[model samples]
Target: MTRTTGYEPLFTLKPVAPEIWVVDGPILKFYGLPFPTRMVVVRLTDGGLWLHSPIQMDDGLLQALAALGPVQHLMAPNWIHYAFVPDWQRAFPKAQTWAAPGVQERAGSRGLALRVDHQITDHAPDAWAGQVDQLVVPGSPVHREAVFFHRASKTLILTDLIENFEAANLPVWLIPLAWAAGTLDPDGKAPIDMRQTFRKGREAARGAIETMLSWEPERLIMAHGRWYETGAMAELNRAFRWVLR
Candidate 1:
């Protein structure tokens, strides 16, 4: 059970964009089923790093991240992804933690005293200004995913919005379940149950998608499964086809 954060087998760290890096976290059980998790790192204009959806940080990983830049910001893209915020906050005491709406309340409910210093809205913060553009995909009551675009690298970063899990990568029994949910590879999409929840806020969700498309991103960095390096915009439109229709 050493899949998620806290008890890590160590996360693999690598560079994904010009100044952005990633730590591929260990697979954790989602509803008793295995699921992959990822954490993204972006270097801000002021020579500090902005961490998105931070994963388990071991000594080695911390050292590696330090080599990239000063860790100045820690972001929780959604409520469900805030579990690791406390760990990162303690590790980087000076870093500001940005919350994605409901995260503060959810963290409190889970008995975790998370320090979320700022809220992530449509406006890009001064630290990441000119480098990253942000959008909040509003729909589900319990979650609101914050998506970011790296202007320099033409990369779009997302969490839980567009998931494309390869069938071979999943446990045998879970393959059918993922496939039925429209989360399987070759044409990865968001979870069907999650999409159904958009009925009440479909317009807001569409607005977010439109904003993402406006960026004309060349690559996509997802928090789950494989990422898209080419034709990213096309894939985004395809993944959110239901919302668009």
Candidate 2:
């Protein structure tokens, strides 16, 4: 079965901080392996929402999000993470969609009808510039993710960089696969193959890691599995030690 177990009570917003919430969504198969999905919701200072790596849109989710604020921005944090963005853009028709470097090309290569309203850069855009800080992490061409840090919440938002899948939640056979991929909980970093892609881009990857570490984030959120609720400095150092050190 390609359907994997996920955090239950999916597609509902759960509080993360004062203005930050997370929506845990259904499992999606990646190359025949099921992986749980998650997305971050930040109600900006203007009451508009900035969704990071948006999950599936359902009626209840749409209505609940509408109550929060207008979905102003739909984020494609990384190339591989933009699958559901097309649906989200249809739901929030006026919402501006942002992509990381190479995400547009990646989407096109996949034959996904996606739109790119803006591309993330070293500086955050006027829409979310003051409230949130963004950086396009340089490393693997396919994994060049636009990572965000919400200054108000001191939360670091990431997608695919660190996937911490719990052993018990996965199928017994998948546990070994997780270990081989280096996604086992408590030690999750990028998957083993993704790490190889950073070899040629080591300096660039280190620069990105250094920037993320400099943020001194308190909470680290990732799309897959359990995220670090505290001690982000240590976690950042530990997770990126392979490339950074």
Candidate 3:
């Protein structure tokens, strides 16, 4: 399918692959500076929507998504990406909320009551099996990220594992920190904190990274920045190269 339109609307709803739509949300103050967020909506073979790393869901956005398919699954891809989960759950009452390991605990810690219907494991659930593959990326004790592979689209969906921020879209003061995090655009890499996470549990992290690499994904969808179209696998390998080495 066609990649982005080179421009992201207020809630950019664009198709990155078959049965997958990404919505770029508003800029929020992150680390005391403006930062953007994104979410992916996947229409399963059964015509149910699986939300990955959800963003702020407004009436307009909800209407747009409903037109595509019934919201069936709201997924918290990682501990750090569950902020807007309660909002989505309220919108789609019938949808089953899936939590990545440690997500429920983390949400509770923040006093944000979460509705986790099921916990996502390394194996793909019955609702999405054969169509989508999943793996729980280990090593980050602070954030356990559940990565997904859409078999029909050969696309890998990641949350915060790799962050790419365009310097022009950020405040001048945030640029240096972004660069230090290895998240600056055109040279997107794993965030510094995540790299340290891997260092703590390198062996386990390596196993998880190898599982992701084995998928040989053709495209990638990220939560904080632009997704990768071509050479997705290469970009992925590069992002976690330190651990890979």
Steric collisions counted per model: 0, 0, 0
RMSD of 3: 3.8
Ranking by lDDT: 2, 1, 3
Give the Cα lDDT of each candidate: 0.84, 0.88, 0.84
Worst 10 residues of 3 by lDDT: 1-10
Error of 3 at 227 (Å): 1.5
TM-score of each: 0.94, 0.96, 0.93
TM-score of 2: 0.96
Counting only residues 3 or more apart in sequence or on different chains, how many pairs clash (N, Cα, C under 3 Å) in candidate 3? 0
Clashing pairs in 1: none
On residues 140-219, what C-alpha lDDT tens digit does candidate 1 reach at each position? 77558889999998999998888888766776787888889998887788889888888898888998899889999999
| Candidate 3 C-alpha error for residue 209, in Å | 1.3
lDDT (Cα, tens digit) per residue for candidate 2, span 161-221: 8888999789899999999999898898899988888888889989988888888899999
Candidate 1 versus truth, CA RMSD in Å, comes to 2.7
Candidate 3 wrongly placed segments (more than 4 Å):
1-7
